[model samples]
Target: MTESVQQLVRYTRIQEIVGDVIRLRASGVALGDIAEVENTDGEVSIARVIGLDRNIVSLQVFTGGKGLSTDATVRFLGRPLDVVYSPNILGRIFCGSGEPIDGGPLLTTDRHVPVGGPTVNPVMRVMPSRMIETRVPMIDLFNSLVESQKIPIFSVAGEPHNELLARIGFQADADVLVFGGMGLIFDDYHFFRKSFEEHGVFGRTIMFVNQASDPLVERLLIPDMALAVAERFAVEENKRVLVLLSDMTAYADAMKEIGVAQERIPAVRGYMGDLYTQLAQRYEKACDFKGAGSVTILTVTTMPGDDVTHPVPDNTGYITEGQFYLHGGVIDPFGSLSRLKQHVIGKETREDHSQVMNTMIRFYSEAVESERKQAMAFELSPFDKKLLKYSKLFRDRFMNIRVSLGVDEALDLCWKTLAECFEPKDLLMKQHLIDKYFPDIAEKETG
Candidate 1:
């Protein structure tokens, strides 16, 4: 005799009681299916049966216990939540649920996969020594975004962090670009798709988007799905993948919500104590797998109220190698740092890259101090005067976000700018480098 099968059951008046919980036994037919519970009001929520005690199963609902009722009907979908993944995901807009909000095709590929899994193991990782040149002066010359380097753009809302990320995707020398947009506004998402398409780079780019209007659960899956597919491309296909995630604050918020649903005790600012570990799991995925392609991550984490001390950014700063702080409509040189820059600063780039970058920034910083002195009517020294002059030239030539230059050209322009503002001796760079790279500015200055 065959074992009897459990029949499906429905509850009609789930909202009649308060503080009531319903338990169901997995019919043993669909173990991994995300069980759906619907209330009499036609409201639906997703829950996972984490504990099964002989006949009764314990489920954790994503939305928590506020509106659910004992009378709610439960149905199992026979599969864990999976995202539709394919090459056609390029140049299209999607909501948090992986649904095409831009009215595109359903992405009917057989390549769907589950998101939010454990990160790559340590034994499978490789040291990150490659450079991903974006040709953006602020990145290539100054901060030097390294391959497999996990970095964040610390910016407040209304800044051009999205635009910067889009520019990098368009220009960066990588085989594939995977972009994950969490809690992005519709306009911003459209802008990214349009920018890539117009630049003719959309074919090599794949976007996983979670908009502000989508359900919160979808936001949690965006990063995982992106990193999972990226890992496959890198390790299996030997493709250099660059993953761009915008507004990680949204991802943090999703984690916080899940923590609340699980009734876990909150740590700083109502965030789960595992916040650091969770972030590390994703960021550590930036690796150069041995004998294969690499995955480099550049994410945007918007600081709420411009507070770097906020829990989200504070934890992020610790986990990431360095940060690009965006402020006042520009990448703030004083606030940015790239810890992995040494790997490529003087190796993959021009010999003068390190010196030129440091000297220009040092002078630019002094120029800022000189401007402050001028504001207070203090007498300016000769060096201060030179600093003020060089600062203006520096801002125009290199600091502008719209400015573009190859690594070599940028270094040459640095020499030109320094020659125009100060004497060769005053540049304080090695005499040998000055002799080799300094343009005819020395003769022009002396004459």
Candidate 2:
């Protein structure tokens, strides 16, 4: 590593004040040079002189004020923030500061790039018609995961959202998986790394982690770094990439902090007014680029205090195509949905897929109503009694997140479950589907 330390003499009089702002006069020849300020006590921060009036130079520090002094030495690095990018970055773990944390040697590649560039234009986007199967029953059979789809897991803390993400990372059909962890606990990060490795999928996975103890500024860079690498792989290498970001609530929190630092006006619940726009920029990055591979994003957005009405989840609901609602250790059939499922459910999957999915969910919903009626001791019809029975079976067989099945198997199971509760004629599905998939429950009943 090359070290070039240049001192800023004029910065001697600089004093770190409230709000982390600093006032300095450039008395040395290092005016306009990027400097890293450190206190005599060995705390470090990066700052750039953004304004200069006469001999006074104004520097904006990346780290918010907590420790500093007039005796702090300012060393100018003479460069802007840059990230190393290359194929060699694959299968490696990097910290939020873009440093390798996987006990590997630093990449000496000259392919350094800046993060947070503009998104691709809409005209450059191709229609997303391809499906990316994760083989998780809830996703594959019911809510189909589509290529270039940007979906979020709307969950609360202590939920198995991270485990769900790791499962998808291990099982997703994409060629590459880029995981960005923001404000994740050490245990969650370890779980993801171990899960990928144990499943023999680590070589195809790239992780950029920002733990809760890292600097706040670094947390803001993790998503961009992960997305930037994913975009490169999708465009240049023509590899289908799946980007998994855990706890986007932390990303939004970083934005809120920056907004407060910049003295911006707060919108709903003290979040910046540009929250929606900022989120859209990142979500829209999920695109099928023309003549290239696609990038799909599956993010975990934990609702604060289990409040979906909170700004983070509220804005996300509008921008994302759909969401997987993780509650009570299950992907709620009624709460979860995939808007793009209609595009490929029947067309790309088995003929009975759409019918079975819809019929099963419809029956499940009716079962809920029937259960309520039974609870109230209402006079229930024979059909209502059947629905109540079917709902219980559906919850046990399908609603459990741990239940894994392929599309065909899930559809077949759906048919068997329905047959146990309702007659074939009462299913209301198409005649062809009824003839093709209905099990021989009639023979069992007669026998």
Kindly list the per-residue Cα lDDT of model 1 for residues 111-154, writing each as its tens digit. 88775566667777777777888878888889998888999999
TM-score, cand. 2 vs. native: 0.87
Which clashing pairs does model 2 show?
A: none
Q: List candidate 1 stretches off by more than 4 Å.
A: 1-33, 36-72, 75-79, 86-88, 107-109, 442-447
lDDT (10s digit) by residue, model 2, range 132-210: 8887888888899999999999999889999899988998889999999999889999999999999999998899999
The TM-score that candidate 1 achieves is 0.86
For all candidates in order, the CA lDDT equals 0.79, 0.83
Clashes of each: 1, 0
C-alpha-based local distance difference test score of model 2: 0.83
Q: Which candidate number would show the highest lDDT if scored against the true structure?
A: 2
Q: What is the lDDT of residue 195 in candidate 2?
A: 97
- Our model 2 lands, by Cα RMSD against the true structure, at 4.4
